[model samples]
Target: GSTMSQSEAAMAKANPMYNSIYSQLPQYFGEQPWTAGPVYVGAFVMFLFILGCFIVKGPLKWALLGATIFSILLSWGKNFMGLTDLFIDYVPMYNKFRAVSSILVIAEFTIPLLAIFALKEILSKPDTLKLKENRGGAIATLVLTAGVALILAVAPGIFFSGFITTQEMAALKQGLPAEHLAPLVANLTEMRKAIIASDAWRSFFIIVIGCVLLFLYQQRKLKASFTLAGIALLCLIDMWSINKRYLNDEQFVPKSKQTEAFVKTQADEMILQDTTLNYRVLNFIGFPGNTFNENNTAYWHKSVGGYHAAKLRRYQEMIDHHIMPEMQETYQAVATAGGQMDSVDASKFRVLNMLNTKYFIFPAGEQGQAVPVVNPYAYGNAWFVDKVQYVNNANEEIDALNDILPTETAVVDVKFKEQLKGVTEGYKDSLSTIQLTSYEPNRLVYKTFTPKDGVVVFSEIYYPGWRATIDGQPVDIARADYILRAINVPAGEHTIEMWFDPQSIQVTESIAYAALALLLIGVMVLAWTQRNKIAKKS
Candidate 1:
C-alpha cells in the first residue's frame, strides 16, 4: 500500500544497523565502491563541480552546501546514524514514501547549481588572485578524484576482492549445472572486476580533461566560451557513454513490435474463443518484474494478477495467503519429482478456479508456445452459496477457505453479521442463475433469477467506491470470501447493477467543470468591456 501506515512499521524494523562510516558508506553512496561509475553518472560529474565550488566563497555556495548535506543525509537511508528513522518517526508525511535514497535528487540538483554559480563567478571577475584560487581548487578536486580512479584502475582487487559471499557463491552454483558452475562463477567475477576497473579509468580520464581545460582558461590561454564548452563536452561524452551501456538504442522497439509483444499466444487464442469473457485469466508465466500485479497479463485480458502500487489490501492479502502459496506448492512438488519447474504448473488450477479464472496459460512442453488450460471448476461471475461460515477475524475467514467449496460456500467475518441480518444463508436452489449481462471497467450488470432469497457472491475485488443496486434500490455489498463482493438478492428476477460511484471523483469533476465555466464567462465579459473601451477611445 502507498499509505504510510500500511508498511511503515515493517520498513522501520528492517532498517540495517550502521556500524561505521568506512564499512557502510559505500552501500549508500554510489553504484559500487570499487567503480568510479555511479547509478547516475551525470550526478557524479556534477559532484566534481560541487567539490570545486568549495574554493569559491559565496552565499550561493553555502546554500548549495546545506541542501547537498541534507540530501546526502537522507540518501544514507538505513545506513546512516538513525537520521532517516528519526525523520520517519517525527516528520509528517516523511514515512509515506519507502525509498529514502531518492532524496539524493536534491543533491543532484544542488551540485549542478553550485557548479554553474562557481563558473559564472570565476568568468565574471578573472582577477589573478581569483584565477589562482580557481586553479588551486580545480587541481585539488582533480587529484582527489583521479587518485581514487588511479588506484581502482591499477589494482581493483585490493579494495573489492570479488565481494561475493560464500553463501551467495553456493547459491549461484546450486542454480547452475554442476559441470558449468565453477567456470561461470569465475568468468562472472572477472567480468565484474573488469567493469569496475574500466569505469575507474574512464572517470579518471574525464576528470583530468576537465581539469586541463579549466587550467587553460585560468592561464588566459583559452577563451571562456571555449574552455566551458570543452569541459561540458567531456562531461557529456563521459556520462552519455556510461548511460548508453545500460539504456541503449536496442532497448527501444518499434510501435508495431510493442503491440505485438502482447500478441495472443496459442493458449490466449483458445481463451478468446470462449466468447464469454466474464471470468479473468490467470497467467502461470508470472509477472515480468518481481511484483505480482504487473500489467503484462492485463494488456490482453482481465487478469487475476495485475500490477498496481497501491493495490487493495484484501487482494494483496489474498495473493499472499492463497494464490502464492498454492503456486509455490506446485513448484516445489515439481522440483521434488526431479522435473525443472521453470514455467507453469497445471496442478495449481484449484486456486485459480476459485478466483473465477476461466483459462490458465502455461508454457507448452519445451516448444515455447503457450498452452491454455480451461478450468472446468471455475465459478461464474456470481453464485449462490449453500452456507456462510461466520468468522471472528480475518485469519479465521482465510483459514475457513481451505476446507469450504468456494463456489457453494463463503466465509464472512463476524463484523459483517449486522449487514447480513436480513440475508439468508444455506439457501441452495439449483434452478437459480446469475449471468453477467453487461460489463465495463467501472460498472457491471447481472441478470439474476433466484428460487429463494439468498446471498450471491460476485467474483470482483471488494473496493471502497463500488455501489450495488438491485432493481434500482440500493443494497449493501458485503466482503465475502475474504476479498470479493457479496449482496443479497430477492427470490424474483432483478437487475443487479454495480458501479463505481465515488463521491470524491464526482466532486472533483464538478469542481473542474465549474472552474472552466467561470473562466469562459470571465473571458467573454472582458472581451465585451474591452470592445466598448476601444469604441470610446476611437
Candidate 2:
C-alpha cells in the first residue's frame, strides 16, 4: 500500500548481498546467462552512432546526443550505484523498474535517426571542402570512428573485460565439484576471445567501408546514387549477418513442436476435472525456474505460482517471507518421509493451506501419468479468524506473520486500525459461521451469522480496488496477512458483499471518451476549412 513510509520503501529495495555486479553470476538470468550483459547495437549503428555526434547539428542533434550519453551511463547498470540509488530512492516509479541495460534502446533508436540526418547532410553537400562544418564533420567522423575501430580490432579485450559472462561462469563453476568444467571453461574462454575479435574486426571493416564510400563521393570518383546504395546495402548486410549468428534458421522448430507447447498434458486434463471454484494448484514438473516464476501451471488451474518481474511489492514480500520458506519446509518433510508426502502433516504448512493450494503436480510416473498430490488442509475462500494481530509498520507486520497460525489469526498493519476499531478484540465461537454464497470475477457474496461482531479474513489478495459492504453499507477493507483481504462484521446473520470497484477507472474512462469526441470535432473542423480553401483556390 502507498501508506508504506519512505523508510519502508528503502527497506523493500535493500539487498545487502545482491546488486548489479552480483547479478552477472551464473543462473542470475536463469537458463539464459547471455542476457545478463549484452551491449551489441550492430556494427552499422556503432559507426553511425559515433559519426552522428560530429555530423548531426541543431537542437535535435543535442537532444539525440544527450539521450545517447545518459542511456549509455544507465546501461552501466548501477556500476554507477550512487546515481542509480538516488533515482530509486527519490524518483517516482524508477525504483519499481529493472533491467538497467534496457535504456540502451533509447540510444539505439536516436542513433539511427541521427545517422539518417548525418547521411542526408553528406549526400546534399558532396564537396566536404565547400562548407567549414562539412569539412570539420568529415575529418572528425573519420579520425574518431575509424581510429576507435582500429584500436578495438587490435585490443578487443581491454574495453570489454569487465562485462564478460564467461569469467563469471568460470568463477561460479570453480566452487563446485564438476571435474569436466575445467576443459569446458577453457574452451568457452577461447570461444569468447574469438567472438570479441570477430566483432571488432567486423565493425572495423564496416566503418572503413563507410569512410571509403564517403571519401570517394567527396572526390567525385563515385556518384551520390552509388554512395547511397552502397551504404544502404552495407547496413543491411552487416545487421543481417551479425543477427543471424544469434537468431538463425536452425532455431525454428516444427509445427508439431509449437502445437505441443500449449497442448494440455494428461496432468492438466486430470486437474481440470476438479470443478471446485476457488483453489490453487502447485505444478512442480517442468519447473525450470522458481515455482512462482513459471506460468504454465496457470493454464489449467488457479496456480499458487506465476511469473512477473513487476508483481506487487507486498505480494513479493509474502513470497519471500511466507511462501518460499514454507514450500522448502514441505519439500524437506516429504524427502524425510521417503517421498511419501501424504505421511506429512498438512497442519505444519499453515501458510500454504491458507493460500488454498489444494493440489500439487509431480513428475510423470512409469505409466506416463502426471502425479497429483492433494493438500488436505487447504483453507477455502474465506475463514473467520480467532483474533487480529496488528503491528505498527510493514516490516513489523510481515515479521509477525512468521509466527502466527494463518487459519486462526491474521497479521494486519496498524494503518487499518480505525476501520477495525470495533473488532480489535477478536471473537471465536463454533456457532459463528461464514459461507461463500456466490462468487464472480468482480464480486463475492458471503452469508454470515456471528453471535457478535468479529473479523473475517478472505483468502483473496487485497487491493485498493476492493470495497466491502455489510448489507449494502460501505465498510473498510484491511490488508491482512501482508496481501489478503479482511473486514469486520457485526453480530447476527448478515449478507456481506465484496466488489472490485476501482472507482477512479470510471472517471478516467469518461475523460477518455470526452477527449476522443473533442479530437473528432477538431479534425472535422480542420478538414472542412481545408476543403473550403481548396474550393476557393479552384
- Clash count, one per candidate: 3, 1
In model 1, where do residues sit more than 4 Å from their true spots?
Answer: 1-44, 56-103, 127-140, 161-171, 177-179, 285-300, 305-317, 328-350, 362-369, 386-405, 408-432, 449-454, 474-482, 488-492, 501-538
Q: For candidate 2, lDDT tens digit of each residue in 275-371?
A: 7767888866654355876676776678777877668878777877877777777766755775576689775677788888888777655663557
List model 1 lDDT by residue over 1-538, tens digit each: 0111122222232223211211222211123223322346353355355554656586867878888888898877767858988888999988766456667778878877777776666666655325554567655665677877889888866776454556546665676568765664454455445555766777777767776666678789999899778868877887787576556788699999978877666677777778784788877664333327456668877888777756777777778788877756654554464444334444454455667877656655666456676655577788888877788899998887777777777788878776666343656676888889998889999998887888888888887788989999998888888888888777878899999999889999999999999999999999999999999999
Worst 10 residues of 2 by lDDT: 1-10
Deviation (Å) of 521 in candidate 2: 1.0
RMSD each, Å: 9.5, 8.7
| Candidate 2's TM-score | 0.81
Clashing pairs in 2: 292-306
